[model samples]
Target: MMESTSLYLSPTIFFPNYQNMLNSFKIYMYTPPNPLSFSSPTESLFFSSLRTSPFVTQNPEEAHLFFVPFSSNLSTRSIARFVRDLKLDFPYWNRTLGADHFYASCAGLGYESDRSLVELKKNSVQISCFPAPEGKFVPHKDITLPPLERVTHASHAPGNRTARYLGFARYNGVKESNLLNELRNDSDFLIESQPSDGMTLVGRLGSSGFCLFEYGADISGIGEALRFGCVPVVITDRPMQDLPLIDVIRWQKIAVFVGSSGGVKEVKRALDRTCKDDECEGLRRLGVAASQHFVWNEMPQPYDSFHMLMYQLWLRRHSIRYARREFV
Candidate 1:
């Protein structure tokens, strides 16, 4: 698909102010906003990444995918107006019923606020961080984006490896409180329940062999762990539905998966089997390799998050065939 890959972004949605809206988060955070804490950087990263891809085309006729790059903060009425105008001005939306079109949003709360937006969800690829099953997130059609943090190659620090087995930072979810209590009592693990700064959290993740990933929270922690070469021990009841880059990364090869029930026992078993010197080294290698897929570069790189998202759209495009329409 890369040979002839092309995308046309709707001009109405890709306005000058749209870029300013995406970059606005940087004005307040000083640094890139943590993908784990807020949606702003995630939105901005995806926008900037796509903007630099070679596949982006000004001529709509050569395009395979049509992007509607709208922010989550846009009013539902404004979104509706854009769609209405696109349908009137361009034949692409009507020709494909928006199946060839897609949009990304990081604000889960904003999407849930407007019911009228459901029509858009039904038709286009809704790339989002929250892939809640009940929220009209069709797993087969939609894409789950990884919460990306701005990291240079030097972000990960080397130390004497003072920390041990596993670390759970800032975990206060009531549903998993029992498991947290169990792990806290165990001497093998480090559990931090209180709020902490970003550097502290990154240091904790870097030092530990494994990091706990709680379900229903920002899965960007998983990305952070991967970045630091820490194996992620996922705690979830269901299968990992929202894992980013699932299309490219074989998650089981690099990370541990455990059920919510018998959480301590499961985590302990995973750690015992995988945290040995040889096995830990292998997982670390895999994590470092997989980390390349999660990063966003100013210019699209091979196997980076931008190209991976494009690859996802390419896969979706091949799933169904559309008859070519001759424009009069």
Candidate 2:
């Protein structure tokens, strides 16, 4: 484990009104999970990260950010009801209009059709796995979370690699994509929509020189590929925002991006152009370097998913000037 570095928060930016807010940065977790409902692995990991962090405080008065850990998998009405109750109990929501609050979800699909929830979400920060389509995800306010997947074994070292070309385990959203058909027809391409088991998927990614990610904003596959030192080939129709930790990680050095409009020929050209042994090795090393940023640790570590999420919040918090408001 790498030693955690001391994080410096500028007093001027972090606490414009309150001088004590700099080193005393605090986060208050609202609404504990029900034993019956249970949190997903990602959600569980996030909560675990918060529990281990030194910044979490039981007192809401000292908090810099209020975390609503409600699962987005629930109905929008359920989430809205929770938010309504929160507002009734605390003055924080009304004061900032939800700007200082945040919630995490695997995807923002639940609140899309709900007008009330949509309006509320626009004011709050949404940390999500898949970037919502237009009118849904506000890039500057919301965060794109890297999908968290556990790696049981250390990735194999780069050497005389046997795997060649690109591969994919699933093809749900991109079935109609011409690139999918093109890669399938090409004799040199190795693509799989279904693997025999989890290990088989890992094996395919581990051996493959490049892994195909066809769906837009899906980082789960990208996470797995990076873990195994396989370079990711992202093919998307939508605008790809900077992958998580864009401020620190150079994604272009580790992955290939191909526009979906370019069709199969373009994708094939990219694969043919970049899958050379030397290029693959360089991508492998860069991927290894960037992989640490995506990991979710039981204890909050430097640049781990937890700290990265906090860092995103830190950036947003520094940008906004919070006025000193007295709450009774």
Candidate 3:
């Protein structure tokens, strides 16, 4: 089925000032005193997107926010050191004490609450993929990046499928437990530890009514299922807010998240509820619509991942005080 545009799911519904944000929102990007290596694909995308967008401002005095771009895999202490150098070299850091600064990182952050980096971690806004402290990242202060590869289009549509459920990818740690031992003999489930000769991974996802995922374990799989128009039945202990733009996107509409602590029967019950009630069609449509939010474009499109990130930055513009300079 072809999916219709969902106006209610649009970010503008919550952020009515998006147009004004385009006109006025200005970010001052700090060129590091030393060269930085952007090792991860996620960091490279964010670095390029911010530079190409109109939100960047050359003049720091009039800027609403400051962006301090860094590379992946850097120790949190290294980041704090980088911030320390900025404080000595630039006047802006002293005025706000890095309160108005932000960075996008794929590296895990907030694990170490080092005394020196406390200001940067607690005061500055962190946009991260592996946001720490488990289940939910702190909102109104931080944004979780959609961990994804670059995609230009979404063309998949929901259709008749052969399997009731498909486990199309390997779990992060397979030794933890064998999934659905009770259904090992069942044909309705196409569960595999890895790909077999029957069909391609993408093919399996497309032909299945629902996909299973262990959220926070293999999050990229969630992106894949959405792109394929398969209603994702996620088994996770994580909060719904752990997802990108969950406050506005209504992830519950597109996906079902079951707690991992629940036994095998719980998984069967959830899947039965979705398929037997005839809700997969609507769920698939909304899941397809949500695919747009996980995509990264060179130039941000409305409600795309980059644009959604900008909305988060816009919401956090007031976290720090921007003071005016005075001359005697």
Candidate 3 C-alpha lDDT tens digits along 135-200: 324566777777664233435653665554543444445444445554454566666664553246
Better model by lDDT, 1 or 2? 2
Q: What is the lDDT of residue 2 in candidate 1?
A: 28
1-328 in candidate 2: lDDT tens per residue?
A: 1112111123233324333333556888887444323235766677667766777888988788888767545767777777878878888776776778887765563455553375467767777654344455666687766667645465543455568655553565444466677777876667665577767777777667777787553447677678777788888766666356554455677888887787777877787778666776777776866677677767766666777677777666542434546544
Model 1 lDDT-worst window of ten: 25-34
Residue 194 miss distance in model 1 (angstroms): 7.2
Candidate ranking (TM-score, best to worst): 3, 2, 1
**Can you write out model 1's per-residue Cα lDDT over 1-328, one digit (the tens) per residue?**
3212111122243234334333321110011112222246766777776665556666676667777755566666777767766767777777766777777766532353343254466667777764343454666777877666634545553555555656654565445467877888887788765336666666677778788876675456666677787787877788765567665556776788887688678788878878776877677666766777677777766667776676666656542434546544
Candidate 2: clashing pairs of residues: none
**Backbone-clash count (model 2):** 0
Best by TM-score, which number? 3
Using lDDT as the measure, name the better of candidate 2 and candidate 3. 3
After superposition, the stretches of candidate 3 with alpha carbons farther than 4 Å from their true spots are 1-12, 111-116, 130-139, 150-154, 158-169, 172-176, 180-186, 193-199, 238-240, 275-277, 320-328
- Answer with 1 or 3, whichever has the higher TM-score: 3
Candidates in order, TM-scores: namely 0.74, 0.76, 0.81
- Check candidate 1 and list the clashing pairs: none
Least well predicted 10-residue stretch by lDDT in candidate 3: 1-10
Off by over 4 Å in 2: 1-24, 32-39, 109-119, 131-135, 156-158, 166-176, 197-199, 217-219, 272-280, 319-328
Give the Cα-based TM-score of candidate 1 against the true structure. 0.74
